[model samples]
Target: MLVELVGQSGRDLDNVSANPARLVNVYAERTTEGERVLKSVLGMDRHTQLDGVFVRAMGRVDGVTYAVCGGHLWRINLHGSANDLGAVDTGRATLCGNNGYVCVQAGTRYFVYDPDADTITEPAAGAFSDIGSVEFFGNYTVITEAGGRRFQWSALADPTDLPGLNFSTADGKDDNLLRGLAMDGRLYLFKQESTELWYNTGEAGADAMARVAGGVWDIGLLSRDMLCQFEGGAFIVGSDNRAHLVSSGGFQPVSIPPVETAIKIDRPQACLTYSDEGHTFCAIIFKDSPAWVYDLSMNEWHERAEGVNLGPWNVAASCKIGKEWAVGRNNGEISILRRTNADGSTPLVREITSRTLRMDGQRTILREFEVFPRQGFSAGTMNLHISRDGGSTWTPPKPKPIGGQGEYGRRVLWRNLGQARAINAKLRWTEPRDICLSTQARIVT
Candidate 1:
């Protein structure tokens, strides 16, 4: 009997013990290169560090990028210049640009920055205290207070001032305390049990400003910083621990069971979401758990682990700067997600396992193992490990030389492999190149 496995996908680390056949990785994916290594933007350099702490908020004003770490702010230019702007607030902060100013909110306090003057000022503290999150809806600065049930927008095109004491409340039964985001000219409100969208009234004054569209509060958002925009819509980790795609029509679960099983429920606040254009996937990362990546192109799931790749992404904050993704790690370093190797030293790790092969309760003998690689890209070496008796143990890895760059249409074969009732095979590599592997197994009962 011959069994072939190609394009390994669908990873559920929570169920790996029971389902080891899925192609999963610490930091790898299946592209034209069977098991290609995933890349980070760039190395952790001085540009990503601020006051010995990782950036907590990243935003852009005019053409300048700003990174906030602790209470200090740094102005970053396109030419890679980082200038300290002294100290400001404490703890984690959120930033957004409204009109010509950068609006920053840390805790219940607020600070506004004028990009042209390079100055920061506090708004007159009267209205809009206890704000939880701030995002822009059209030209208005939309805000949600600490508790749910109500949200408001600032005066048109303004972030420092609001229109009187105007506020709008969600009349839905599930409008409990949560977060919000502004996208596509609508304000998305998330709660524990439901989600709601509000559109602009264009009134310019009081009377609750905006109203919730009927029947859109069907699903809710989980994880505060876990909202990221995708090609068709935005993806969020639902309060139910599932991944959802929120578009104009509402949301639907895009996460598989394995993706759902890997979330760290206890540390929900520590989760971060980002879209990787290189791999074309949306990654949901948790500090205490391995990353669960959803391939946007294939709509599939894969896993990423630090132990798999020498240094996987454990980012605290991430944003798309220009065309690439810039992220700040917990260790006080800034890195970019790129196709090249990190600092030319980080090793890439990949692992692909085949589905269990059963001989219908009859003992079998394995004769040979073969692997096929896609042509054209640079290739290195892969080690093979075989397991009999239901993947409980794997044989010592045997060395296999992979085809190098320009070695097109290459195939590797290993002969004289022993067999049992059930068996699985694994392929692993640790190089800074691509590995698109397709495997074939020969067995006899």
Candidate 2:
């Protein structure tokens, strides 16, 4: 009899006893015939390395990409050449631009960059300080005061002009503002214990923006960096320890139980979103845990890690430069995703662990396990490890060659002579070759 090894969707729940299907560095894609198959994720290749220690944030303005790497602001051209614009603070930064000017809020200071003249200038000292987050809306730059209930806006068409009296307080709830987002013709003020939605009224000064009546939500934001705009809404890791999609309707939960459990354990430090191929992926990065990515197109979740130690996907910020998706790492490197199996020179290890199969305490006889991997790869091997005791321990790896070049009729089969009441299995590979698997795996008793 044939049993399903890989399913149509990825589900890695919190409770292993309930479900143990783990998809790492791979996702389920529906073919033209509506058959679900596993496909390896695109790898990252080095675009350029800056002279800074960490690439904190990235943004694009007027067809130019700018990044805050270490204490300097860089202008990255189309050919992966970085020109140091000037020096800025080194902490986490947020970049937004409008009217040919880019506004950067690094640490507690805000700087405005004009690509036309190649000049970086700090806003008037007393104009703003202690900025928690920044965004551009209605030709104005908006900012939230850290640890306070006030949000301010810049002069019309002038991001560097912030009038002293142009600020308003989001006091619908007695919570402090954590971030400010301008999206879909509205401005969202996220606080520690709630969120308020406001809209532009074309008024002057402090009355230019007004809160929508009955637009307050009980859901609070965890951090300013954990929020990203997706589709027509926004994706955020709420203070409730779960990921949510906040749209015009309200907050909707998007994280699974396993994802929630993982977030609850380590908590996300930052997040970024970018579109590749036909899918939009929001990657949530933690301090000490693997990164979890949400596929908005398929509504599924998967894992992404780098190197042999399987650390968090080393992505600090990401933005699309022209038609290419560019990611900035903490090590001052910028990379672009391509159709390969390695992250530059480092090999990307893909892994998947199957859910435990329990036979009601009835031992099954020896059988053969077979997998159907896409053939015609130049060279590679798929290693399978079996666990008879529900993944408590794994057997030695058994490697099988995928196929040679033009060899499209290869079968990855493993013959075994063992019996078990419960069976668990894992498959892993690390090669700079294309690898894909069908959703079916057969086991004959």
Candidate 3:
């Protein structure tokens, strides 16, 4: 499950997890006061899906939690609730308000969006081919791709002109598949083709892998080196053709076992993600099915729970938040899992019922729907609510105006608000009095 977003464009995290939990813990940042708080949950419900193997995050726009999957040249932000924020469609990528463009693949292209007005524009950018992934670091956006080609986006360039990237990694040739990057503040690169893993010194044909483990091709980037999972060394491959950390750092080597028990591989490339508690998670293919969570501290591999299986996904994206993880499949299946127990054995998996109801690139066409009565509108006020789960429930939250002033409804701000899948509520205000209740129905997951 690829959870977090990758690439040079779109959104990333500002701070790392500060608090730790016995089973799992997460930090709650108070946007109103700008303070990040921490909390620990007893056990996760098996009914809720909270698994993410890619690099998605539990984000908040105006205190709303969202599930986002990002990769490729530029990261994508799925607005609204986790259930509704579908995968960032490749060709369906649209532009929204302020005429600001999303610089992907390290500034190779800029996809501009005007959400308020509902429009998407791709500014001609020559940076596309060379760009891999982009993300906003402190002041600049960091970009990387399968080759680990790193760069930054510059605003000085013409809006139509490609963003000037500031950095480069000549060592792009070091890793063949470019499995992992920047683990423990140091970039970890690996190419399954290599006989000896090499490290990148910013040059080609360098030692891209560390002597971390044997028969290793998968790598995950944790906050710092102190955090990360090792297969002690048992690893697995998922149906998505991605790799997972099935076991922890210390495991007795077992024979390849039977070809039936384990799956075969040609270029067995996989990815890993972390739980909100920083627990390492790996999803790999096993006997054709993509069985995941090989080594969750709860049960030792041999004695631990076998965990769940991910259906076929040509390209799967994942990310983690506390004990929860999310897996977004290309087939339009998003399985959210929570670590019910300390170990990965028992997990709470839930399929999202909500899908993309409507996506209008043109605003006038969207506003055409009169704000008046309809078949679904016999009650007081009906706010359109989206879910990360499979459209099972709906709750509209209070609307926070931009700049804290109740005047204008900024597009960028609403777009950002939509990122919080849990809190991003679509208000159905038949009367002004009903607006306050919107926040009361926010989904905390």
Candidate 4:
């Protein structure tokens, strides 16, 4: 019988019991270039690992980019050159840019970078000190204290002075923890157990900040690094242990059940989030597992594309400088994604693992297998591996031609795949470009 499989979708590794969602290196989508699936976000391999175990923060000021990794700040020049600024002795780094400077907070210490002078130094003696995190709104530099219950902003436009500025949410009520987010003309205070909205009270000079009339109680933010501002509001990890989109209509759940199941709550403090323009998606990463991507256009959840190793790629932090989207790797390397090839110098491997197909308790015989590449992918051969018994083992990989460019609709076939009680498949490619493809199987009962 000719069993025609539909288009392959993005990776759905969490779903081990069903088929229909095509787990692939890229998902199918119609673009201006024609109907094609995603190509794995290309990475800069020649840049290898940086001098740290993981990248903590990324920022750009005056055309110069910086990354906080291994407790030290490093100047990153995407052309493969970097300069370390020394150790910070902090577990995580919080960065915010204002005016012409970028401020960095590590533990109880704070430092500001002057890009014009190429200097990184602590603020003056009378300036604000002992800050845990930093955010800038207008000319005001806002910060939370170490183990403190309130947040404060600089006096006037000076982050180096404190005798005059008086902006804070210190109502002597609760410990309004976490960093502050300035959005839609209000300051959003995220506590460990609740959320508060504060706005300007029209009170001159000093008494400008005041809490909103009614705050969203009960719902609190969980991950500090996972907070992201989208077109509507912000997507964050809520106290309910699920991902939520907090906006004007109040907070609502957006993360699916499988994603919530994979989140490492105990590791909440380490999660990270960023947006991808190439794929039009937002990604929230729980360090211990494969990261989850939310399609901003579709408002649906999917897994990050996988490498040929058949495992999730390790991306710790991401930031956009100019038009390039760069990611900091868990291994301390900083590279750009969404390129046509892998890092230009290193050959990146791409893989696709299909969802489990059930034979309904009947042994199924695979008579033949057929593959189709996108109209543009012409030139390399792809390898195939078949797995039975739920991925316990896979047959030796088989190689098939992917055809050359201009050879659209060309099909490659393999005969006698052997019988199995249950099965799935994996396809890998090393020299593939525009490799959006589909497959079908000829089976016998």
Best model number under lDDT: 2
Worst 10 residues of 3 by lDDT: 4-13
Q: Which stretches of candidate 1 lie over 4 Å from their true place?
A: 6-17, 25-47, 264-279, 307-312, 341-344, 374-379, 405-410, 439-445
How do all models score by TM-score?
0.86, 0.96, 0.36, 0.81
Candidate 1 residue 96 C-alpha distance from true site, Å = 1.4
Q: What is the C-alpha lDDT of each candidate?
A: 0.64, 0.82, 0.29, 0.64
Candidate achieving higher TM-score, 1 or 2:
2
| Count of clashes in candidate 4 | 8
What value does the lDDT take at residue 166 in candidate 1? 62
Model 3 TM-score, 2 decimals: 0.36
Q: Which candidate has the top score in TM-score?
A: 2
Ranking by TM-score: 2, 1, 4, 3
Model 3: lDDT equals: 0.29
For model 4, give the 10-residue run with minimal summed lDDT.
Answer: 4-13
Q: lDDT per residue, candidate 2, 7-40, as tens digits?
A: 4223433555456677788877788898777888
Clashes of 2: 0
Model 4 C-alpha lDDT per residue in residues 34-125, reported as the tens digit of each score: 54344454444434357867788877766677788888888887666888865665566677777777778776777776667777777653
| TM-score of predicted structure 4 | 0.81
How would you order the candidates by lDDT, starting with the best? Answer: 2, 1, 4, 3
